[model samples]
Target: MAHFEKAKSIHDWLDQRLAIDKVNKVMQTEYWIPKNINFLWAMGMVLVITFMMLLVSGIFLLMYYQPNIATAFDSVNYTIMREVEFGWLWRHVHAVAASVVFLIIYIHMFTGIYYGSYKKGREMIWISGMLLFVAFSAEAFSGYMLPWGQMSYWAGMVITNLFSLGSLEMNGIVEWIRGDYVPAQAFLTRFFMLHVLLVPLAIMALIGIHFAALRIPHVNNQDGDEFDYDEESAKYLAGDTKGSKVIRFANDFLSKDLFVVAVYLIFFFYLVFWNYGFAMDPVNFDPADGLKTPAHIYPEWYFLWSYEILRPFSKDIGLMAFGFAQVIFVLLPFLDRSPNVAPANRRGPFAIWFWLMIVDLIALTAMGKLPPEGIFSTIGLYAAVTFIALWVALPFITMMEKKK
Candidate 1:
């Protein structure tokens, strides 16, 4: 205790002038984090590292990238890959990292939903995370066009025109968004600006809000008891600094988080260097031609679940369905209203149905990639119906679970 006081006295002396202690209280070691959160809790940390890698690599790529209609593909494939220093490595990392980031986010969001992390006080945090996902989806789409490859061009065409699926009036909205009738130079330029500047700024702001929201509510744990750490944490707090039911953010969780992040990077870099073509399509190697379309135009895997729902419907219905698909997560806080939180102790039928929905999502993703000609459309219809039914029935189903 005497040694600790000497250390605190020095910190206080520094605080009298530097204000370093105050800053550290908010931005560094002072925040309370629940120590009981499991491996699933590290998903957010993985996302943070992934985004950092994407940003650093993307900045380097931007130094050589030309986003115009005439030169974008060659700029990325030939100039950046073959000419620039370590450019190939960065490009591969950026590409692989983007997909990995989304995978982590899906796990994070699913973990939240499974454990009821959004139930009472954490609603804003969940909503902010969902908004971040939306921004990420938009950001990824915009970046996809920067390659200016055949798949990029067609993907741009399919998605930009998707907005016009409603009616004649919707065409005007699509035109406004595209700034042209088709995915031409104007579309590319605007998307470039969005990818480089606007979307990233939005992402940064959303992340700030996400963390700020977390400050008040303790991290959700496996037990489903939000204040489960109260009794245990109280012993660690010295004197009257003993309020929050939490552990030091820097050590308790940081050590475990760093280990998981290190493990994740090993696999990610493995895919980047060795298995370099994970989610990418080979058609993306060919420069974009306005006149030619690929025999099969498939979206990236993350977008596949929604893409499948879109295949069997009329334009208007499909548009609505697609919109709902992106925003489905925002509705989850309201959907599963069961008082129980732990996945193992979660209400009857909810867990079974939730896992089934995950399976349906995987099935739909597979169907999305397959050509929609023969068997895929039928499978898509079934998967889509089952998915929609699960979400609609989730709240009522969980309300009946026996509570802890």
Candidate 2:
């Protein structure tokens, strides 16, 4: 055994053993962030807060949630909402956070694209972020099934059936996924396992990877200026803080993040207390009945854009388009051939391309919610085609951008 010195205090003792001070220095105190960033940079913190809310509320809700199909509906609708004390509040927070998290994620993603944050050296940040997106999507889908409501059941059914691969007839994959021919006991149990355990763990791991990726590349700023971080950070550390172009991540940058998070919490609670109906589908109020199908079955709004891509074409073609939409975004760092790393407005045709893509996706989302008929069908088809065409055009349009 090694000789030991008497500890100064609990923190000192722990720091000596665990290197808490070093961790703080690395992850917080010494971590330098560019001062040129705006509130959009705070979305990562907001996402963490929202995910914490989801996890806490989910744990409380899970305490009373019954996985069995026969009791799952009543456990949520009656027992948790009406019987448990303040369970309704937890449910509302969860429902609103689940929806709002995606809103924040979209804003974060677009902000990244707009600022060219995904360009050059920060590919892992983008890729890890996309992986987090995929993990969260899976978590949401699995959680949606836990309610055992009409829309939940049918949405699960419809989404799972896609695994059948159209004419390829690989429905064994579907049944294997569902753990039965239908969304019954085994299906519910499997999804409950995923929602409550597996996917959340995956999300947490991906969040770690995402943050780690950010540490090396640092964060891209609004101006996309490639300043010397080491030099600026030295200035900050050496007491020229006001003159430095960077700030410590601990008190300086975190203060800004907290301000944005506070504002977001205000908006979030407003939804939870009053406007949460948007997050909870009205159709989900009904208990799942395999015999009854809603006249119009649609996914939650966040998924609408991609769903519309799959809606307009023939089955095989639709699947292809949908797959393209899903995978194309992950390939964005490679797709944009421009050497420049600046806001879209500064980049010639790329600016138009960015705005058009945004508008097209918005159009696709709107059409996805409406019944596919008459003018809606025609518009969705055009929008779907435009979406794929835009991605195909990205490399060529960006290649023409003059070096800046």
Candidate 3:
């Protein structure tokens, strides 16, 4: 009874200041999720768990990591991996999480697309999610440079060079971005700041915005069935939960999220412990050497589809296409004119377009990893053209879609 009173007192004290009950209702206990969602709805929770793993593992690595171009490679390869206790485990966890997070993000993004979650009033949710993706991309790129490896240096050089706008010769912008003609000390320092502080902060802010966006529309169900959230939530609160079409976010939905997260963690740790080599590039094992470029310099796989889009054309055309690809996704809510919010499989030609786009992106990713020549180049060009054409055809096909 004494311990119970103490807990009550603490809660009352905090609630008086923070309105804990109201905030809890607003964010969790009274928050409603559709009962019709599948396990795929849990991807958001999985992403959060993966990000937490990245943060914890990154903090461990940061304690030993030196950002200097001279010592960064040795700091990672020799000092951390060899000298520090269990440093290899931390590195492996970080690397695997970094790579695997993108895979999860892609799944989450496509799930949103497949279910038409970006349509109508849910635009901000998709926009915020895309912003988070951009933030994560910047974070990954900046973190990659910290290793100061052969692939890291060269990839940085290649990417930064894109700022040189063809005949416009915006070399000054490229130099300014790098803080030099090449990726040197200044470049490393800047990216280190971005990776550790700026980009992560942006990502956190975007995540909060994403959640806030979800609150109004709630989550779209797999079947795209619309219901009165307020009425269903009242039913749930009134002890009619079994009859209601919605569940509370606190314990009910959270339990489902936890189950899915547990399974994902099992798969994630398997990669961390056993198959982490896929995340760690072989070329990155070598220290940064500006004189000798690797046979192939590519961004990580997540960026490959876009890289392929840029590669298949001449300088100006490729740049335009790359810019289009980057911004087109954020504009999906506008481009898709369909009134139906059902999954793509039920949406006629949209089903074909969705699967074809998926196939094209897969082809682009595969082709991106290879040298841009002969058969690969031909395939990549076709894939890139198909990607653009699909987006161009989105409004027309979706407009013709019969409203459900």
Candidate 4:
């Protein structure tokens, strides 16, 4: 009873000050969530935590990083890595954390795709996420140029020139983006501003909206089955009953989310400490030199799948294709006409096509690393075709599929 009184006093204090209980009760989350969701549900929270890590580490990195082209590379290699206290650790964390963040984000996306998490009533959640991906890609690309290395310079040129292919105004836009005729100190400064300031703000805003939208839909689960929340809230508002089978967010997910976060952090920091530069482009270590280019250039591995898609066409046409590719993914909720939420509910080519697309993507990512010539380019072209074909054909294929 003494302990109960103490807890009651604390609760009363918080309630009076913040209306804590009122918000929780109004949100319809008594900390409960759908019990059917597995470990995959934790991925979003992991992404949130990783973003926070990047922000903190990035702030420190900015303190030492000189955005000027002349000193950029040396500042990182010497000042950050060798001179500043714990600067090496922070630098590695920033560089390595970017890769880890992207890795998990890809998994989080695929995990959603596999479970049909975007189906009905949750379209906005998926759209917000997809838009977040767009913002994220732009953020990563801009940040990549900050190092001002050979890979950064060449990759920036290759990517930014894609914007140069349109009308006269489009070319002007390219110049505006670069801040010069070519990628130079001015370009780096502009990129630094976007990478460190504008983009992060955009991402934070999107994240807030994403969570707001998510709470409305309540959340999706692995079963793809309807939640039967009437069991718990039968006496409550009928409006809240529309999306049921829910549990309180704090109850079902908290422990599991924490456990996964712990594991993820361990693996993340392990990479930061032990294998900091794994899978990074070796050519990027060299200072940028426009006079001589690396024999072959490629993006970070997460982007390789899309890069392969870009390889088969001319600059203008490929830019069109890539543009479509970026937006179409988030539009999946509308694009797919199938009524069945779970892939298993349909016993037909939908599942086959789904796995095929996954395989095709994996193949394309692998092929991206190989030289885009001879037999390899041919294979990449075929793989890209297959990948696009599956997505394009999903609605019709699902229509023909037999429902269980």
Instruction: Give the TM-score of each candidate.
Output: 0.92, 0.98, 0.97, 0.90
TM-score of model number 1: 0.92
Window of ten residues with lowest summed lDDT in model 4: 234-243
User: What are the root-mean-square deviations of the candidates from the true structure over C-alphas?
Assistant: 4.3, 1.1, 2.9, 4.9
Candidate 4 per-residue lDDT over residues 226-295, each given as its tens digit = 7555564552234454445555566446778889999998998888878777635688899999898899
Measured with C-alpha atoms, the lDDT of residue 112 in candidate 2 is: 94
lDDT of 3 at 254: 98
- How does model 2 fare in lDDT? 0.93
Q: lDDT values of the candidates?
A: 0.84, 0.93, 0.93, 0.80
Which residue pairs show backbone clashes in model 1? none
lDDT for 345 in candidate 1 is 34
Cα deviation at 66, candidate 2, in Å, is 0.2
Best to worst by TM-score, what's the order?
Answer: 2, 3, 1, 4
Residue 120 shift from truth in candidate 3, angstroms: 1.8
State the lDDT at 179 in candidate 1: 88
lDDT tens digits by residue: candidate 1, 1-404:
22322335776867766778778765656656766578899998899999999999999999999978899988999999999989999999999988888889989988987787887778899999999999999999999889999989899988878877667557887889888887889989999999999999999999999989897786788867666444545545654434545667777678889999999989998899889786567999999988988899989999999999887677777777777787887988788777666763355687787789889999999999888877788898889888888888887887778767
User: Candidate 1 local accuracy as lDDT?
Assistant: 0.84
